[model samples]
Target: MSLIKTEELVHDYIRRDEEGNEDGRIRAVDGVSLNVNRGEFIAILGSNGSGKSTLAKHLNAILFPTEGSVWVDGKNTMDPDEIWDIRETAGMVFQNPDNQIIAQVVEEDVGFGPENMGIPTKEIWERVEESLKAVGMWEYRKASPGRLSGGQKQRVSIAGVIAMHPKCIILDEPTAMLDPSGRREVIRAARALNDVEKVTIILITHYMDEVIYADRVFVMDKGRVALKGTPVEVFKHVEELKALHLDVPQVTLLAYELRKRGLDIPDGILHMEELIEVLEKICR
Candidate 1:
């Protein structure tokens, strides 16, 4: 069964004057429908202000749809009473690690989510340890968050969400503010959680390289889904992606350019190994 589903979802932004009179309206998320199955790794790709984040907000009931419906774990998001349950089922990680970490110590920070839910103190500590270990941050559990590097801090922030035992995780540009190495660490951790923990992952990323591991990819443009498919299927449209102001993976781009220059290499060469194989085939 699908863990999250959206039907004809629409969200609008009203341009108003000082007195709140509506000047005009912009539909930030237009009539879009999507379904995420349990234990799937999904990537949403878009330019800035493309309504990808707006669509994500609907997953956890952070924002209500102006029209249509959203269901999280079989519960309607519009139901006010189910809000907490939905939030508990779907945890969100934002771009900044500093904003997400509140507790001084890493272990304490990880336990806060379950602690606030009125979980027993003993169980909360157990959950904290397990969650920290899951993210490979157990060694830093006793360290202050301020003393940790960006990658470590972000993992701790993720560990806090994991302690809640959420069925799904929505990460909105989680690595945008990090350096390349830090980005690698967070992405690796995210993939590990999705692979081994059976948690649903919705990764919102602009970096084409970062999404090669996702099971499916959705491309958003101007508040609409422009393309949807597996990584190879979607990245094959080199010209179309370029027209949308998006770039393909580095190796994909190189292969596309090489193919255009009369090389027999195929389209959608996503990895370096694939490009090398194609070149070897030509030499043979």
Candidate 2:
């Protein structure tokens, strides 16, 4: 069964005037319909103002749809009784780690979610340990979050969400504020959670490199889906992506260029290794 599904979802933000009067409406998400299967790794790509983040908020019920419907783990997000249940079933991690981490200590921050859920003290500790270990942050369990690097702090943030035991995770540009190394660290942790723990992951990112490992990719523009396919299938259309003000992975771009130059390379070369292997075959 699909872990999350949206049907013709539309969300509009009310623009206000200086006098706090309703000026107009800005459609953030426009008639978007999609399905995310259980244990799948899905990536959403969009330039600024494309509504990917707005669409994610709908999955967790942070914002209700102005039209259409959203079902998270088979529960409607619009239902008042299911709001908390929907949030617990689909946890969210945002772009900034600092905004999410609240407690002084790492373990305390990780345990906060479960504690608020009224879990037993002993079980909370168990969840804390498991969550930290899952993100490779267990060694820093007792350390102050202030003392950690950006990557470590983000991992702790992820651990906090994991403690909630959500069936799916919506990461809204989780790596946007991080350095290259920090980005890699958080992405690796997210992949590990999806691969090892069978957690369905919906990653919203601008980095083309980050989506290479995703099972499917969705690209948005003007608050609507512009393209949807596997990474290879989507990246093959260099012109389409460029027109949308998006770029493919570096290797994919290079391959596309080579193909344009009349080389015998295939479309959608995802990695440097793949490009090299193809060139080697052409040379032989």
How much lDDT does each candidate structure score?
0.94, 0.94
Kindly list the per-residue Cα lDDT of model 1 for residues 1-284, writing each as its tens digit: 79999999999988999999999998999999999999999999988888999999999999999999999999999999999999999999999999999998889999999999999999999999989999899999889999998888899989999999999999999998899988999999999999999999999998999989999999999999999999999999988988888999999999988888999888677899989988998999
Model 1, position 133: C-alpha lDDT score: 92
Stretches > 4 Å off in candidate 2:
16-21
* Candidate 2 residue-wise lDDT, 1-284, digit = tens: 79899999999999999999999999999999999999999999988999999999999999999999999988999999999999999999998888999998999999999999999999999999999999999999999999998888899999999999999999999998899999999999999999999999999998999999999999999999999999999998889998898999999988888898999988788998999999999999
Top candidate by TM-score = 2
TM-score of 1: 0.97
Residue 101 C-alpha lDDT in model 2: 91
How many angstroms is residue 95 displaced in model 1 relative to the true structure, after the best TM-score fit? 0.7
Clashing residue pairs, backbone N/CA/C < 3 A, model 1: none
